[model samples]
Target: MSQMGPPRPGASMPAEKAKDFKGTFRRLVSYLKPRRKKLAAVFIVAILSTVFAIVGPKIMGMAITELFEGAYGQLQGVPGGGIDFGVIGQILAVLAGLYVFSSLFSYIQQYMMSTVAQDTVYDMRQDVNKKLEKLPLEYFDGRPNGETLSRMTNDIDTIGSTLQQSLTQFITSIVTLVGILVMMLTISPLLTLIAVVSLPLSLFVIGPILKRSQKYFSSQQKNLGRLNGHVEEMYTGHQVVKAFGHEAKSNEQFDAVNAELYDAGRKAQFISGIIMPMMSLIGNLSYVLISIVGGVLVIQRAISIGDIQAFITYSKQFTQPITQTANIANIIQSTVAAAERVFELLDEQEEVEAVTTSVLARAKGAVAFEDVDFGYGDNLLIEGLNIDVEPGQTVAIVGPTGAGKTTLINLLMRFYELKGGRITIDALDSREMSRHELRHNFGMVLQDTWLFNGTIRDNISYGKTGASEEEIVAAAQAAHADHFIRTLPDGYDTVLNQEVSNISQGQKQLVTIARAILADPPMMILDEATSSVDTRTEILIQQAMNRLMAGRTSFVIAHRLSTIKHADLILVMDQGQVIEQGTHEQLLDKDGFYADLYRSQFSAKVAI
Candidate 1:
């Protein structure tokens, strides 16, 4: 149950918190490479907008000085001269021009960054899905459906938003902040000195807040994943919960995690909220310090009034950028946390990819397991085994619970690699062949039936993607599913939303069987294929399966010993190994595990 993630970095707050912020910022910008030209446009626009923003205030200060010095007339001849409407018009025109550029560039930056973010996320999703298909069954065995889905949906969305918005904002803010600093120092180092003195204090307050926020933010997401997993469990097992009268227990478990998530979310958000207000308060206080001192210097006539006005404007300018810097730090931290999780899936070692490909090589349905040893991870499910099934033979594998029945099928399909030994189809090793080539030879019907949200015909034809309508109907008839399928609203075209939930369980199994039958693989695996159906339906499906196994090598894993009485080779497995092998009557006479299981299960059914 342990997560196989790398050691988490720098959760504990370092003494130099700003240093950590800078490091995280640098690392986050590394993913913007593939669209460098588009991003470069964003960068140029961001710089221009920030420059104009700083220039706007400087222009206002210049306007005030122009009125005082009689270059532009003063309002109502109040200070030095009459107002010059002509020059005022020019200033306003330039200001409007700069506003136009800023607005237009804002749109461009957002459009470009959003495009990059979405495209990169699209690529990530496809790659992760491909990786999931490549990973061995063991990886999925330890996880629940909801958690895996949470990783795919909620987690991916979080990563996408962070990459799209946070990356753009943080980058723009940095460029803006640098411009403000340079302007502030150029206007007056003395006032800029007093304004920037608050930097150490802003860091002092926000450092701990960032660290605490990061921890709680991470915990909140983990709790979200758990809550999602719990919800999925409840939904899938709703019948069990209601039947056992354990709904109260389930509710209590859900409430406990819900409460934890609420607390963690509030704590993280509260810390983030406190940061902005504190930064504002520090900025205003710094603004006041610079304004008061600069006013005194202007009154003493040591500095020009115009210089003092620009100095005051730049003081607040510098302080506003400082506040912007704090939000940038927070943004980067949250994004890194999200990316860390996303990258985990991106970097997982794909289930050993095959070195050879032979898709056109038709298997002769000769399957041999030579000295195979395997397990779900380290649990040791199967050990050093040997079995051979020639073409056109029906092999039945019978076993008790946890006896590795389905495990054998997984090995043959290359869903899990053999820990030791080789599986060969017509002399070529399974590992040497591409998984698509190896699995192409199989038509499998699992005990747990799964029907996607599609029409009955669509479900059946899923295996054979390009099958004609005649072929689909033919496969359905062979599986005894076409009769009921015809009763639906649109018949073969009737869409089954949220799975084929309206159909009976036996019908669902039949439809699944039809899907496999449509593929018409050279080998088939029926793993307790009829375990869910009624006696009458069981017989019908059994008849269909007999036809399926006629010319193909087939293996049936079942607990119903009666079903496999006529198997060409019957394997009775125990504790992950074959304890006995023979047909039904042959095993009944062995007086071994097979006989005892047959006596317990078959005798009761026959007596009934």
Candidate 2:
């Protein structure tokens, strides 16, 4: 078991700044293209809602002016002097109607925008999922599981929430700003000028805060992803950590990541949080100036008192949108950062799509590797490797660790593309056949058994879709797992937990063997499939595998030399090339590498 190690230096450092903000933001907006109609509705409805709400203060001012004039006439004992409550009632009715329509349209806009947001993200998630499926295996091999998961879940979620909430707020804030500005200018340009002065001050305050907070926002997102990755890794491997007594070390690493996240998040929130209060203070100062000027205009009979009342209201409303737009800018900045991460995943190099000029419905299982050259990166792991297998031959590959045994299987199954030469199945080029067609012809049982959280029957039936109860039971019996499976409380219906720890290791191997048996493909690949069982269970599994491999082209990667003594052809591999190839007796008679390895293992067993 491998123990968890400390995080690499600078692992918690803020991610590099977004490289293409405009490009990434534009791409993010493209998801909305499909829902442009709905988005258009949202935009128009937002404008209408703001328009109605914007007219409210002006209309209410009329009522105030009517009451003021009426009260003054009554004080002068003029005829028909009393305040006209009837006219005020009519004004209130119209005002109520405006508010009602404003709220209704606001709700409509919210509903429409939410759907658009959800639909856009739905398409984005679908695209990300499809891209993941098309990406080459090397992408996964080079990245951490948790890091990839954070991109899929956390990063996408950030995009979703920003779309749902911030996008609509952004639309409404702009419209509110424009509408309130128009309403204020109609009342008095001088007071409007006083109100507009606050705009520059507000911007001055917000500029530095935004610039300072933007990096922290980016850092906050990056550190959050790192923290998620760390937590996921530690939680999943907690058993190993405990067994290795690395709890203290794991905690130390966690603390380091957590501390970094806290620092970034605190700075980001604190800086962005200053925008609102600063905007309010500036708005208050502008309000004082607007009031003094408006009061002077009203005293000079240059403007109605009611108009001054309405101008004050408009000034407050004007500054609000500016504040909101600043906050939304911060939010959009963070959203774009998240979108860039998702786009990076989407832009990964995909596996070369297979062009099927020849379709093999049922292969004869004659697999051949001719002059094959391949490597993970630059250094060739296997060069000029040639191998041929006739139908119905059991070929066992024996090699030390890193001897290219698994790489051979990976190439055969088309998991990785060959670098120099081509592989053939039934005399047809593997590349000419679709990967789906090529991989479907083989069933594999690896050292690490994979079983999902489902019933035993479902897991077994996974090897062959729609496998009947009889077929599943027969396959289990063939693998020698049926007897033990029946002893459990739920028998075939027993659900495997997520970890599949309900059963012993040997039992898990047996279940996997049953799954392969049910598959019954034309060829089989077994990678130390029986290595996890006891002696008796190993013998049972070997017998089951022998039966499974009969009359089928099977490749077995065996570490224990004794297991492949009966194989028709045994290839002894070292350093990515086969050094010897013959039957067990022939190799022993030659007294080559195979003989030395066999003797060593036999001697070790005897000593034990």
Q: What shift in Å separates residue 380 of candidate 1 from its native position after superposition? A: 3.8
Reference-based lDDT, residue 156, model 1: 74
Model 2, position 200: C-alpha lDDT score: 86
Per-model TM-score, in order, reads: 0.89, 0.94
Q: Against the true structure, candidate 1 has what lDDT?
A: 0.77
List per-prediction Cα lDDT, in the order shown: 0.77, 0.87
Which parts of model 1 have CA positions greater than 4 angstroms off? 1-30, 67-80, 302-310, 357-360, 377-379, 606-608
Residue range 1-608, candidate 2, lDDT tens digits: 11112233334555767778889989998888888888889999999999999999999999999999899999999998989999999999999999999999999998988888878888888998999888877676666677778888888889989988998899999999989989988998899889999988889779888877767877777777788878887888999999999999889988988898899889888888888888889989999988888888999999998888989999978888999899999898888888888899999999897667998998898988899998867778789998988899899998788777887888898778889988999999999988888888999988888999999999999999899899999999999999999999999999999889899988888898899999989999999987777999899889889888988999999988889999988988887788899899999999999999999999999999
Error of 1 at 387 (Å): 2.5
Query: Judged by lDDT, which candidate is best?
Result: 2
- What tens-digit string does per-residue lDDT give for candidate 1 at 1-608? 01121122211222111224445445445655677888788788777766777677666666666556664345455564876767877877887887788777777778888998998778768867887776666656655566667767887788788778876777777776677678767777887778778888888998998877887766666667667878988998899999999999999988887887798788878988899899888988988888788888877876767767877777666656666667766665665655555555566767777568544367888889899998755666678898888888899998877677777877888777778999889877888888888888888888888898988878999989899999999999999988988988789998877946788899888988889889999999988888878999999899999988889999998878889888989988777798898777788788888889888886798799
